[model samples]
Target: MERKIVKVGNSLGVIIPATYLEELGVTYKDTVDMEFNHDLQTLIIRNQKTKPNNKDHLEQVVKGIVDKYLKEKGL
Candidate 1:
């Protein structure tokens, strides 16, 4: 695939297609890590390493265990 660099106000940037972003599981307005490789002469884009909100996950797990324990006691 080929891309064109267009002028964006003061700087020039390449317009990434929506399909590419969709395939990468990222969308507009999301922050991504971009790196330029001098050896390979290529650009790399990747999703940032961020942990999910695990508070809800922990709460659900505790609730499930409590429910199972109560059920076993016929409560």
Candidate 2:
């Protein structure tokens, strides 16, 4: 597939097609990682960010800490 770079204010930006976006599970307000390949002379794209677990780990750690304190306080 080929794409043209258009001028965005002072920088050049390329628009991604909806087909490719859906195929790659990309959506609006999503972060994407971009890298330049010195060897292949191409642009490399990846999802560098990690999805946060729904269950809060910090809350669990805090609960454990609070439980230990309560036990020590004899409450």
Candidate 3:
């Protein structure tokens, strides 16, 4: 589905179809994570509350684990 960018108060925005939003299980006021793939020239969106499989999320989890371990070991 193609959508045209329209002026939204000053910034340009695209109006996402309600069907697509419903399929994504997201409604107004819900947060989403958006990433742009430079190579593919695409935009990817995911529900913020969902478990992320991205590298940044993985690094955060690892850092948390390491921090907890260091704290427990009093190091």
Candidate 4:
């Protein structure tokens, strides 16, 4: 698909179709890696898996494991 660069505030940007983003399993607030390939004259976009910062989530997971271990040891 062809896209034209449009003005975005002070910088130019291209509008990526929503369908393309959906197909790639990406949504708003997701981090993507973009690189320019001079040899191929193409721009590569890839998903950068970002772990969500959830202190409560981590505590819950660790607590679950510790509880299981304690149960197994009967302590």
Candidate 5:
């Protein structure tokens, strides 16, 4: 889905749809972790409660970013 970036106070932000937030298991006032994959030109957001603080999880995130980059570049 395409969403427009709008000005929020002095910063820019996008309004995530309620359905998407529900799928992510997050809601207003809930904390989330966000990461920008510069190589893939992607923004990833994860529900903080579900975020795994482990080496394996970090490896998986990196692998996913690499895979997306490769797919986008048709490597």
Candidate 6:
């Protein structure tokens, strides 16, 4: 698909079709990755990389584990 870049206020931007946004679950203010294809001489726009979560469900899990330990050890 081809699109034309237009100027908005002080920034140049492209209008993405709503269908693609819905399919990707993208929303306004979401971060995007901009890459240049050196071989094809083109630009690739994608979702920004996400950081890995090292503490998934940590609060509840820690509470449960501590409670169980206290009961088992009679602390």
Error of 2 at 7 (Å): 0.9
TM value for model 2:
0.58
Best by lDDT: 5
lDDT by residue (1-75, candidate 6, tens digit) is: 788999999999989998877655668988877789999998766656443254864675688799999999999
Candidate 2 collision pairs: none
Q: Write the per-residue lDDT of candidate 4 for residues 6-72, one digit (tens) a residue.
A: 9999999999899988855689999888889999999977556744358975896799899999999
Best by TM-score: 5
Tens digits of per-residue lDDT for model 2, 1-75 = 889999999999999898877755778888878889999999866554644354774676588899999999999
Q: Candidate 1 local accuracy as lDDT?
A: 0.81
* Model 5 ranges with Cα > 4 A deviation: 52-75
What are the TM-scores, per candidate, against the unseen true structure? Answer: 0.61, 0.58, 0.65, 0.61, 0.67, 0.52
lDDT of 5 by residue, 12-60 (tens): 9999999989988998899999999999999999899986769988898
CA lDDT, candidate 4, residue 59: 93
How much is the lDDT of residue 7 in candidate 2? 96
Report how far off residue 27 is in candidate 5 (Å): 0.9
Error of model 4, residue 70, in angstroms: 58
Task: Kindly indicate the candidate among 1 and 2 with the higher TM-score.
Answer: 1
Backbone clash pairs for candidate 5 read none
Model 4 residue 30 lDDT score:
90
Error of 4 at 13 (Å): 0.4
As a whole number from 0 to 100, the lDDT of residue 25 in candidate 1 is 79
Q: How many clashes in each structure? A: 0, 0, 0, 0, 0, 0
